[model samples]
Target: MKYRFALNNDIPNLVRLINNAYRNNIDKSWTNETQYVSGSRITQDQLFEELNKPGFLLMVIEGPDTRSKQLIACIGITFYETYAEIGTFCIDPSFQQAGIGKTLLGRAEQFLQIYNSNIKAINMYVLNVREELIQYYERRGYKKTGLIEDYPLDANLGMPLLDLNLIEMQKTLI
Candidate 1:
């Protein structure tokens, strides 16, 4: 597996991968969101805008599966002066449970460390309803920061089957 920042040409496939892992209900058992959401997690336009943001690193993980070396996973991180926030993290459902998500996260942390030695923490938000996902992050050393945010209706994330909120999680890297 190879990890690198996504290029301009990677947006479409990235959109597909994220939606398949987050919103699509077609045999995607890795995420709990599928049971609650029924639309694409992100659109190409949104992803393009995210990629162009300052201090935002959209990373893609490519595999040697196909002849073209297709991307199988991805994540987005926005760096602040002394910390960073991670989002848009997903692995293709077909590639889930194979440790790809964990590996991508590990590599991303390492890369961020190299890029910003002053970074003291890595933060992210998990759907409060997704207990399993929260546990996963907790097992990886993230602790809740006592912050909760309402799911945005205009974010185009999806149509929620139930009320949802995002809870903050952070891991101190320093």
Candidate 2:
């Protein structure tokens, strides 16, 4: 098991991992209604643009399967001076319940620690409607910050739902 930052060429697998984690997985917090209504798709071009942005880190976990290549998990981070935002943190559903998601969260936290000396917090915004997801994060030591906001309608997130509220979760690294 090797852990490394993603390369420019890994965007395709990264996108697949994320989309599968939620929009496609049966046990995922995101249901068919959510994926269907949202049109959940991200193109390689968009991923490239996102990757080139400042303070964005894309990390992937890979290992050999007997028959083929596989993407086990991934996490993306957008860092700021005082804090960092975590997005698209997911493990393949096939790899779920195997501690891959926990490992990815640890990596995300480690990445955040590199920027701010105090590393006041690692933050994320999850769909407010995804109760199971929120509970998952809570179990991982992230507490609700009571900050809820809507996803941008024109944010190029494949497709947008009519109304979406995301609740913020924060974990203090120090």
Candidate 3:
């Protein structure tokens, strides 16, 4: 597997991956409802802008088989002085349960280390109700801080959503 910064052309594939990561969370199994019912998606423009931000780092894991380096996995991060936030992280479902996610997370942490030596932890908000996913991260060294965060939703629509409430999880890396 190879990893590199995401460029504008990778946005489409990245968006599809993000959607697929959350698409199954409709009314079926208690996930993001507000986005599910509607055709909510992370637009390419949004991604392009985010990637252009000063402290943002979006890395794409490219498969070795393809010369174009299709983005099979991604980890989005935002650095804020002393700490960083794990905004969006997803691997193609085909790559799920593999160590790709962990490797991606590690890469993000490594990136954070450069901006601040005090980069003591990386923060992520997981679905408060998605126990399995929360557990997945927990097993990878993240811990719940007992803090609950409100998951943002566009009030105009009613869609199936699960991670509406976010639980703060942090992993110390410094």
The best candidate in terms of TM-score: 1
lDDT of 3 by residue, 1-174 (tens): 888888887888887776665564444322333442455447677777888899888888887677866677888888876678886687776666667877888777777787679778888987666787789789888899899966556632234444367789988884
lDDT of each structure?
0.86, 0.73, 0.73
> What is the number of backbone collisions in each predicted candidate, taken in the order shown?
0, 0, 9
Candidate 3 residue spans exceeding 4 A from truth: 24-38, 154-163
Candidate 1: regions farther than 4 A off: none
In terms of lDDT, the best-performing candidate is 1
Q: After superposition, how far is residue 141 of candidate 1 from its true place, in Å?
A: 0.3
TM-score-sorted candidate list, best first: 1, 2, 3
Global local distance difference test of model 3: 0.73
Candidate 1, 1-174: lDDT as tens digits: 777889878988888888877877457647637777777788999999989988998989897665676888888999999999999998887778899889888988988899889899999998898888899999999999999999887888888889889999999986
Candidate 3 TM-score, C-alpha based: 0.81
Candidate ranking (lDDT, best to worst):
1, 2, 3
